[model samples]
Target: MNATDRTPADLLRSALAADPARPLVTFYDDATGERVELSVATFANWVAKTANLLQGELSAEPGDRLALLLPAHWQTAVWLLACSSVGVTAEIGGDPAGADLVVAGPDRLDEGLACSGERIALSLAPLGRRFPAAPAGYADYAVEVPSQGDRFAPFVPVDPDSRALVVDGVELTEAQLVERARADAEALGLGPGARLLSGRPYDSWEGVSAGLYAPLAAGGSVVLCRNLDLLDADGLAKRVESERVTRTAE
Candidate 1:
């Protein structure tokens, strides 16, 4: 881990600086037969745009709580980093009623509506498509995110020591998150160039660590699989070989 990396966003920046073209996130949805790969640069770009949307359009300030009701998809990863970039406290599967903002998938719109603050809904469709009919009282993420600036510059500096995430009622500051990610990386035997395939969901700290932070802190990459149980043993093995995965967490 780089000494300069204090937050997850910093880790992503370091990864982008080291190798813009290197694959950082490879996502698979076995239920949909969808595969999407994002290089460090590409992932950073998405984070930047989403960060801009959060900070500019949504007027999100540091310490603001954002209830994130999304699944373990690439876009969910993007939102996590975006929240880190702007110092928003992301709450995975958190109650929307108490949040400053709510970001949800189409299936979670009803739950998200409990938040009187800003609300954004994602289609979670292949290619990030827009909903045929936009959900009422919530902005369409796929429609709005594309128009956001490619570069994000926070009006207020993010504090590395500020709360950054809450998973399963456990709160972690940005610095703590980085430290834990590094520790998890070491425990998982992840090193440089290590590729970990994770079939875990995003509701728990372990799942978040395996799917995003651990490999990131290790200067490696992750193959995030959704609905992985549906894949046969042969198919899973073939995928491991094809993706060059060195480790797995399920």
Candidate 2:
């Protein structure tokens, strides 16, 4: 694949072509060992749909700062990629206080609701209808909102040199960094169907840019696990072995 032609979205494209029927995402939810598998195309479509929903429903313009606050491994990846591909600016934060949208984790639901002062926070669950929940001051992040459609309108055109990420008031363009990382990843021969299980703190732009999107830019999957300590060693081992995770970078 030509490096210049690739964007973060192409990761899903390549994976769908090479391993469409293969399990692209296998998430182990609990110690009970219940697992869920979502194919590459299916996941890609969901992301596209989600991106479109954010744009149409929430009026999320390009470079709009969105706070992604989910703990589920697969859910996080999908949100991040959707934002990247859709050209929406994102910041990962536990507290949804200043964010435009908060994708709260199941465990953080109550705490997030309680502390969300003048912030639109919500719980994301796959179990029920996405009825709007007026939890005092925040809006509900109903699962149905992300399920309304399956088509992304189109990626908003942003200058490659446009400031896409901000950290501690330090800003950088997405095209500048991602292009560089994409070059390095290609030089290293990391490509489609490769499972990259990563253990890195994503609160920083480097982790998100290099540790996450760079791998995807190379047509490889980057699975993020913020806290592996909670999972028993054996359970983690089983996941690693079965996933055939081929790489890791700090």
Candidate 3:
């Protein structure tokens, strides 16, 4: 990570500036035999559009709480960074009733409806497809996000010391989050050019760190695997070799 990076968004910007073409996130759904690779620039575009949606359409402001009820998928990673860029405090598996906004996948739509504020639902389909019909009282993310500008600039600048994330009952400011991610990267032995394969779900701080933040803070990339347990030992080994993964996070 850059020494001057003060927030997770800064880390992503540094990565993009360093090598926009380099792969940043490689996602796999072993159960469905789906694989997707995103370059730093491509991922940044998604973050930009999503951030625009949050800031402009959803009216998300700094310090507003957003309950994020999504699984460990590529779109989840995008939303994490988008929240960072918008200065919204992302609460993983948090109570929707108390949030200013809620983003949920198909399975969690019922729970997400508890939030009275803006709600967005994701299909989480193979290619980020929209739901056949919008969920009641919720905007369809896949449809709304695409029309947003590819470049995003928040109306209000994010404060480095503002609360940025809440996971597992722990609240962390943007600076603290970046610091912890850097430390976690070092502890995991991830460095520049390292490729980490992670099978952890996004239900805890450890899972979030290992799956996204650590690799990002280390100027490395991650191979995020969903339903990884479904893969056999030999299949796992072959995947490791094929993806050139340097480390494994269970």
CA-lDDT, candidates in order: 0.95, 0.58, 0.95
List, in order, the clash count of every candidate structure.
0, 0, 0
Q: Which segments of candidate 2 are over 4 A away from where they belong?
A: 10-19, 29-34, 94-102, 106-134, 166-172, 180-189, 205-211
The ten-residue window of minimal lDDT in model 1 covers: 1-10
- Candidate 2 lDDT score at position 209: 46
Give the TM-score of each candidate: 0.99, 0.72, 0.99
lDDT of 2: 0.58
**Residue 85 local lDDT, model 3:** 98
Model 3: how far residue 112 lies from native, Å:
0.6
Q: Please list all clashing residue pairs in model 2, or write none if there are none.
A: none
- lDDT, model 3: 0.95
* Pairs with steric clashes in candidate 3: none
